[model samples]
Target: MTKSDFYRLCGGTFFVLVSNARKPIQSKAECYNGITSGLTEPEALLALAKTVIPDIPKPMNSEMKTLKDNTRDFKACLSNGGGFFRFGDQAVLKSFDVRVRQDYKQPLAAMNDFMDEFLDIKTSTKKDEYLVKGLVELLDADKEIGNDEIFYVRADGSTMTKSQILTASELCVQPFLLGLWHYVLTVVRDNKVGKDTYKDFCPPRGGAERIYTKQLGENSKREIAITYCDIDKTDNDFTEPKEHIPGENEENRAYKENDTSSANEEAASVPGTVINNNPFFLNISGGNNSIYNHVDKVEINHEARRDKGE
Candidate 1:
């Protein structure tokens, strides 16, 4: 079976086998919750598996027997030196009774061949360097966002401790690792610094038109026209007013007139005062005595403008 298929079918069994040897009994509700929600502890998961499948046995076949017997040894090899060694290969392969072909020159090679053939487990030539890199990336991304204090969130929305993630990394749990990698990428992408060029290709073709004009040259008249047409077709097209409220037009005109008169009066009172028709622009003028001299900046409320259909 493929690695994913094997894990899918027998992940619980493998967890029990590689976990603490003594299996505990769990309540029916706990078992159901553990299996369904995927938030239970490994020990609880093992307990639940046993409670559901009491007839589960070790040594069901030669392949299983080899895997069951050698997994601990393999784990030990990794724990001792953080990698497989030539000397430890024989001990790791002791459970596999198959004879190594004469063409194979080394014990490590023979062990790798048997493990791959029987258990779908391949020995990495890099000695877990890639796994370490993945773990480091995950941790770094977490730290970058000040999430180092928080537990890692799994794909199931359950939280995993740092130690749990580390253990899973060591065991090379494919699903967990894939989820963690995806999370790390998301974190990195979210916290990434720089302009988002992808949005230029999205809707609201103003940015796209500018990019196209700049890159393809202003001589491309047809493309520019097409870009303009696309922009006009969008929902943001404001060429014509969509709605008319009763007395709304008159109210706005009156407000603008009053605001202009107030501005004109204020300007008359202050020396060296300048006025601009655009409410969004600040009415700045020379002389420290001007009323606007105290105003460092002006801000426009776009939400209010949108509400008023400006």
Candidate 2:
């Protein structure tokens, strides 16, 4: 379906009642102010299941709760990815991420295909207008290129045609944002950064960032430029190695006291840098060994509702 058609279809499926309320009227009310006047439970559930793009099994009470939870989780994912998206933010990016992560064995490939189809439908019509100019204007304005306005001129004349916008968003914005989310959630969350160095190694918040889309020659070879300033090394620097004392284990104590072999090996392994791989040995401040560097992964996922105390 085309973009408008897709939205209309989604909008029309509002009667699908997947809720905790068992009674028909309660379900109806919960669904949407008694909109599902004649829809039966089975029908409502089927529609609800269908409403989900790339449908999965029917949501039960707990699953319905999970869907609601997914909706909540989407925002935090978006925020962690890159603050927010202007339009179709959660619907396109987070929705795809959640569905693929929950059901598909491989998410990135599936998400890429999903976005491709999404853009194809949305951008079927091409205007003779100079699309690249609007694209540059949007990037110059530092606006989040969205799905619908993914094409067409905005009030400020700073938006690309659907085709150009989609290419830029997928290549530049989605990868960086989604990859940041994945890295933060999977890599940093799994104790990969060592508990002792957590405080020091946590990614610094905010940076001078820039992104732009470019077309090469008349062949329409498009590329996106992404740039960001590195965090100042002088502020809360993590590279400086602290003196590490040995642990209670006699072997470790002995190694620390007498063995320069491992240190030599590590230095050789990573030329021009000192190694502090041992967590128990670092000389960070007391009572802060297990303290996380940034917000907890679980907390980031669940923080939307919790922050509101809901």
Candidate 3:
């Protein structure tokens, strides 16, 4: 049977096989939680098969015998570093095969791609406020800002360590969601990174999106928060005018008017500031100041150069 078929019939049981060599624990045909405290990996496999087909031995024929004989071999392969032990599902196997073949410099690159897809497909349905809050919890930038740490790494090699990126005045905070998504995806997909990490690495997109996203978000909030913070600080002096109080008069209004005019002038004169409602200049800040520089244009006259052959 194919690996996917094996998983479908056997659940993802690993421990039961190794633990119980003689008395194979019968699986109640339940979805494998990837846990087998009292059971061995082989037993878990048996449990998984039973879950899929009540009378697995009768239907599976000689396959059941083959599984029983390979119990020791499976345990050994897993104990030794033989890469991930995959079973059940062609798409899952194919996706992993492709991921393995791709040359990724970053340790978490494949996981990040998976996560980006997950976020693009699943998290898009969430409300703006929920997404914003979810991002804050997931990245932990605010907490990390207080401690002064690197927030998260981008695929481009840049890091979001400072409180500035978290601020609305600086990078607008949304772009960093991509980074957080990458981090969570890696942690969840790799069994080495998490307990039962390999479990549900490629769950059905529509059927399990909410449950998976929520789990990943909740699990990753504290770690991400340690690296990033949302400060929203800006250098602009503009402030909203206060409402008139009982003692306030036209004199107060005149002062407020003057302040507004001066602030406008200051904002206009700021170097590298974009004109007329363009958001592109929003990236210009202390960290990115050096990126903007003037290049001198020299006008060369071709007629002024005489041919040496002449």
Candidate 4:
């Protein structure tokens, strides 16, 4: 694959993964394991890419740096490693690290457009045009110098052409990108950031309830109701109970009606009764002697009628 084609296919994902990998939120050991494992078994990476690619930002035009400057910096970051170009130069790497971190926080659509412009093969600046011409001249010189020499070698000790190496690099990078993506998502979810976007990208946390809310009417007369299963009940057959204080058994917990006892051991007990722990459930204070019973199910019935005056 050509460089532009590869970027078109995996550029957004590659940028996100590499930027996040530089500063993993999880332990370094775990992050490394995720990447290495992906390299061995690339199926996971392909699966993740299918689900993740759609959400990744598209390439946009960036004003952060001039095209000429960015292209020069990009070329400096790469070194020909006999067969292929590999990342090199500590200063260039550090520069990219800072740029990527800031780029990641930019509005998704804008950042995506910037990446596209950054990777564009056609140059708009005279300086960048000269750089591209110089690169072409270097490639021509290499062809003349190594006309009979083998340049590309595979892990299995087989020979490959430069074109084949480009395609191989695409395959190799997928696994590494997959590992980084996994670690980044884990950190984001754990820290509870990007809730509005990443929540849909990653799997829901364990023991999280799937609540659905519905609106019954419009304007002032609208009534909103939420529906969810009480997964804590025995009928639900959930293996794990809701999180609570350590050493406190949920089964032994008691619910008191109209009693203001501070001690758990002294509170009155109601057998086979479950408490509604949902935050949305109304809790009446300054007691007018009201007790809300927990029900296993709730059904809402609504009917619409037109007024005679209308």
Q: What TM-score goes with each of the models? A: 0.19, 0.20, 0.23, 0.17
lDDT of 2 by residue, 61-97 (tens): 6555544444322222221112221113345445544
- Tens-digit lDDT track of model 3 for 106-152: 22333232222222222333332333444443233222124244434
> Model 4, 1-310: lDDT tens per residue?
3221211111222222222222113455877677433221122222222222323222134622333243222222211111111123334334333422443222222222222223221333322222222222222222222333332122222333433332332222222222223223321112122222222222245756322111101111212121111111112111333445645454344433223243322322543233443434433323223345643222221211122232
| Runs with alpha carbons beyond 4 Å of true place in candidate 4 | 1-115, 119-124, 143-145, 148-310
How many Å off is the CA of 10 in candidate 2?
28
Clashes of 3: 30
lDDT of 1 by residue, 1-310 (tens): 3211211101222222222222233567977777443222322322222212222232334444444334333222221111212112334223211211221112223222222222212233321233333333324323333433333223222446554543443332332332342232222322112112212211245544211111111112221110000011112111322345659889999898898788777676654445556544453222222334344233334455556676
**Candidate 3 segments whose C-alpha is farther than 4 A from its true place:** 1-116, 121-132, 138-146, 152-155, 169-178, 181-310
How accurate locally is residue 172 in candidate 3, as Cα lDDT from 0 to 100? Answer: 25
Best by lDDT: 3
> Residue 252 lDDT in model 4?
44
* Model 3 lDDT-worst window of ten: 8-17
* Residue 234 of model 4, lDDT score: 16
For candidate 1, list the clashing residue pairs, or say none. none
RMSD of each: 31.5, 28.3, 28.4, 26.9
Displacement of the residue 226 alpha carbon in candidate 3, Å: 21
lDDT of 4 at 218: 16
Q: Which predicted model would earn the best TM-score?
A: 3
